[model samples]
Target: MLHLGLGSFHRAHQAVYLHRLIASGDERWVLAGGNLRPDMADTLTALAGQGGRYTLETVTPDGTRDYEWITSIRHVLPYEPSLAGLIDVGADPRTRIISFTVTEGGYYLDGRNRLDLSNAELASDLDGRTQQTVYGGVAAILRERMRRDAGPVSLLNCDNLRHNGERFRAGLLEFLERRDEPGLLDWVAAHTTCPNGMVDRITPRPSPDVAERVRLVTGRHDAVPVMGESFIQWVIEDDFCAGRPAWETVGVQMVASVQPYEEAKIRILNGTHSCIAWAGTLAGCHFIHEGLSVPAIRRMAMDYVTDDVIPCLHSPESPSPIDLAAYRDTVLARFGNAAIRDTNQRVAMDGYSKIPGFIAPTVRERLAAGQPIAGVARLPALFLAFLQRWHRDELPYAYQDQGMDPAAARAICASADPVAALCADPVLWHELAGDARLTAAVRGAFDEVHTTFAGALHG
Candidate 1:
């Protein structure tokens, strides 16, 4: 197996599952992981130096912690601008599956799931100027595999994207089309499969304290130690073109279609996670636990799930009816985990993406059904306030976003009707901008936030 974007989540989630399989005497699948971006060079170096071994720290809500050595990643490839090593790994016949976790925004697709060729990095990649973007890197790898006839392969996307596999395939094929490589596109269609997947774990960045804890528990210096909540879940579409590990044996839910599980997770867990992040940041809180600890913030999140999302998702005749209330309570309990210091800044970084990806789905659904959106609109309202504060450089810590346009965002924040200006952003609100119901709901939510949350954040 070849894994890209070897970040904290990959180590804490997928690697841990594979580790379990390995411990149970299944060694057919091991991991070859590396970063596609340069920011994780330090982590790559540390993992490579340690022969792809790292300590995992799992924390319970009540502060109980456990440590384990995760050694499933047998190969740690170094990063390169050309992505030569990654391409080689992709082309290797023994590597039947190449999985990725490029976050929600890294696919470089617009809201319509079309390739955003206008992005400069993407433009360069498509023009053969670089092979850095996921599109660019994947295309290059596929070409080599086709040339060498590396046989059928599976591309598992373990991210929070809705119908991730289908969307990723669309963008990838479009990228190949732009490359004028009809042959490679056809080859991929005949030779590859992209399985939709949903992965969840509250993995925070490895703090210095985590490293120190690793040292105390284990007689080793683990610079790349990863910490997460004890709870984790992975649901994948069982459509591997080549073959896949017995992931089910290790508790992976291999389903025929992961849509039900994916939608429920995106709306309940991911959407509420964003709610906590934005609310937590606005409330001058350092961590997700602190945010969820706020009674009002926590209740708002629960209401979003119980009142808005649950109704949309729970259906009697459907194949899978969700226990959304149970999921909401479980998510709140996870967020309130003090030992897992999931940061507001980390969770809050991608509001632009989250607004559309996680929150807006519920907003759009509720508006069409003439249902109460007061609980749902809070996500975008909190985000708009968060964005305005970001415009004023008022965020407590440094942050970046794929959807940020500093000048335009600042202008909107300073407009006579900042909330309206924000609501009308074609990229974020989509067609909902003209809807009277949405506009009013969002504005009311924003005002109510100030009335209710201003003190907690300011104090």
Candidate 2:
């Protein structure tokens, strides 16, 4: 397998799973990983120096800390402008699976589910000038594999996006069509399979203390150590074209349909996560645990799930088999793990993407059913408040949003009716962007957020 986006989450989740399989005497699959961009150069260098080995630190909510050496990654290909190493490995027939963990916004799809050409990277990739985007990188690899007649491969998507594999395949196909590569597109349609998969692990960016702790526990000075919560889950659709690992043996759920799992996680877990991050930042809390510590913020998350998402996802007429209530509690408990210390900044960075992907679906569902959206309303309301702080440069930390257009966001913030301006953003709300019901609900919730959390806001 060749994996892209060698980030901390991939290290903690996917790589850890593969390590378990390899440790269990199934060494048929080994990961050769690299990044499309030059992210984590220092860590990649450290990992390569250690022969593609690194330590993983996991902490349970009850304060149980553990460390293990992960050696599933056999090759850490160095990043070059041309992506020669990645293409070579991906084009190899033996490399049956190619997985990636690019974040939600990285797909560059607009509300209409079409390729967003406004993004400079996608534009360049379409022009065949660079392979910086996921579509570009994967396309280049597939084109080479076709040229070399390297047989079929599975394109696995390990991200939080709903129907991730299907969505990514659509984006890739659209990209190929625009590039006028009919032959390459035909080859990909015949030879590649994109399997949707859900990945979960609360991996925080490694702090310096993690390295120190790793050295203390493992008696090794490991530089590229990763830290994550003890809780982990992965549910994948069993539709690999070429072949796949026996991930089921390692507690991975290989299901025929990943829809139920993806919807549950994306809404219950991911949506609540964003709520806490935004509300926590507003309440002057630094970590997710700290946000959960605040009764008001915690209540908002609970109510959002109980009042909106659960009802929308699982109803009386057609009930879901999964124990959604238990799942909700488990997600909240995982978020409340103080030892994990998941930062509000990291969770709060991608609000522009989260609003549509995580929050808006509930809003859309509830509104369609003529139900009150008060609970789900709080999320967007909190985001509006957070964005105001960002606009005023009052946030304690920097905000990062891949999907946000700086000029457009600034104009919205500067507008006389900022709430209305925000509610009208098609990128964030899609067809419901300027809906009066959405604007009204968000406006009311905005007021409530200020009044209800007055003390926290001031703090």
Candidate 3:
């Protein structure tokens, strides 16, 4: 397998799973990992120096810490400006699976599920200016694979986006279509499969202390160490065109449909995570555990799930088999793990994407059912408050949003009626953008942010 985006999450989650499999003496599959962009250069250098070996640090909520040396990534390809290494590996017939972790916002799909050609990166890729985007790099690889008569490959999506596999395939096909690669499109359709998969593991960015802790526990001066929460889950659809590893043996759920699990995780876990980040930031909290420590911020997350998301997901007519209440509690408990020390900025950076992907669906569902959106309404309100801080340049750390247009966001924040302006954003709200109920509900919630949480804001 050739995996793209060799970040900490991959190190902690997928790589760990593969390591377990390899450790069991099933060495049929080994990952050759690299990134499309030049990121984590220092970590990559350290990992390559150690022959693709790294230590994984996992901490349970109860503060039980464990360290394990992961050697699943047998090959760490060096970053080349032309992506020669990645393309060569991906075009190889031995590489049956090509997986990636480009984050939820990286797909660059519009609300209508089409490629957003307006994005400069996508435009450049379509015009053959560059091959850095996922679509561009994958297209180049597929074209070469077709030329090489590589038997087949599976394009696995390991991200938080709903229907990730299907969506990515759509974006990739559209990208090829726009680039006028008819033969490539036909080859992709015949030779590859994009399987949707859900990945979960609260892997935080490695702080400096993480390396020190790893050295203390493992008696090795490992420089490319990664850390994550003890809790981990992966649910994938069983639709690989090419053969895949026996991931099911390692506790990976190989199901016919990943819809139920992905929906549950996206709303119950991801949505609540954003709420905690936004509300926590407003409350002057630095870390996720600190935010969960605040009763008010915690309540906001709980109520949103309890009132809006749960009903939409686990309706009386079509109930979910998973014990949602237990799942919700487990999610909150995971967030409350102080040892993880997940920062608010990391969770809070991508509200522009999270608003539509995570929060707005619940709002839309409740409003369509003639139900009150008061619970889910607070999430957008919280984001608006958070956006105001960014607009005023008051945030302590840099905010990174791949989907946000800075000028548009600034205009909305500077508008006389910021709440109304936010409610009317088509990118965030889609068809319900200008709905009066949405506007009014968000207005009430925004006012509540000032009135109910005035002390936090002022403090």
Candidate 4:
């Protein structure tokens, strides 16, 4: 197996699953992928020095901890600006599955799910000037595999993006089309399969506390140590071009379709996670559990899913994909796991992504059905107020968002009707824009949160 974006989440989630499989004596698959950028040079070098072995610190809700040595990633190639190592792995006949976790913004998809060729990195890839973006490097590698007749491979996307596999496949094919390589494209069409999956693990960014704990317990100065909550979930589609490991035996929910699982996760877990992040920031909390501790915040999220999202998803005629009530309760409990110390800043980093991807789908569905959208609109309204705070330089921490325009966001917040201005963003609302009902719903939610959190700040 070849995995891209060997970051903290992969180490704490997918690698853990692979490690479990290895423990079960299935050692056929091993991970070999490297960072495309030089920013992670030190960390990548440390992991390679350690032979791709790292300590995983798992913390439970009750503060109990377990440390395990994760060795599923047997090879960590050197970092290259061109991602030549990654491309080589893609071309290798033995590599049956090439997976990636390039974050939500890395896919370069427009609202229509087409490749945004105008992006600087994408433009560079289209012009064949840089081979770094996951798609660019994958295209190059797929071409080499076709030339060598390297046989079939599966492309597993373990990111949070909804319909990730299909979207990525679309972007990659569009990318390949730019080169006019008809034969390679045809080979790609025949040889590669993209499987959509949903991954869940509360992996906070690596910090000094985790590294220090690892050293104190294990008496080893191991770098690349990752930490996550005790709970973990991975739901994958069982579509593979080549044979795959018995992941189902190892607790992977190998199902026929990933849509139901993906939808539930995005709307409930991810959506509420963002709600708490923004609301907690306003309430002057640092960690996610701290925010979730506030009864009103937690209740708001639960009610949103129970009263708004699940009803829209579950119908009288069809079976519900998940136990919505149980899932909602479990999600809150997981968020309240203080040992994980999931930060509001981390959860809030990609509001521009979450607002649309995680939160908007429920709103859109409710609006289309002529049902009440008031419950779902709170998530976006919280984000708008959060964005306003960031625009005014009031946020306590550094904020980063690849999908947001700082200047435009600030202007929107500064306008006479900031809430309305924010609602009209084409990047986020898209076709749903210009609807008076949504604007009013968002305004109501904005005032609701404002009276709660903003009042607390003033008090």
Clashes of each: 0, 0, 0, 0
Alpha carbon lDDT of each predicted model: 0.87, 0.92, 0.91, 0.86
For 255-313, candidate 3 gives per-residue lDDT tens digits of 99999999899999999999999888888889999999988888888899999999998
Local lDDT at 247 for model 2:
95
Task: TM-score each candidate.
Answer: 0.97, 0.98, 0.99, 0.97
What is the overall TM-score of model 1 with all chains considered together? 0.97
lDDT, residue 433, model 3: 92
Tell me the tens digit of each residue's lDDT in model 4 across 119-218. 7888898888887788887887788888788899999999899999988998888888887888888888899899999999999988888989999999
lDDT of 2 by residue, 1-459 (tens): 999988899999999999999999998999999999986788789889999999999999898999999999999999987999999999999999999998888999999889988999899989988999999999999999999999999999999999999999999999999999999999999999998899999999999999999988889999899999999999999999888999999999999999988999999999999999999999889999999998999999999999999999898897887899999999999999999999999999888899999999999999999999999999999998888888888899999999999888888878998789989999899999999999998999989899976875632
**Which residue runs does candidate 2 get wrong by more than 4 Å?**
455-459
Tens digit per residue, CA lDDT, model 1, 43-107: 89989999999999999889999999999999999999878899999899999999989777777
Best by lDDT: 2
lDDT of 2: 0.92
Worst 10 residues of 4 by lDDT: 450-459
Worst 10 residues of 1 by lDDT: 315-324
In candidate 4, which residue ranges exceed 4 Å CA deviation? 455-459
User: How far off is residue 355 in model 1, in Å?
Assistant: 0.8
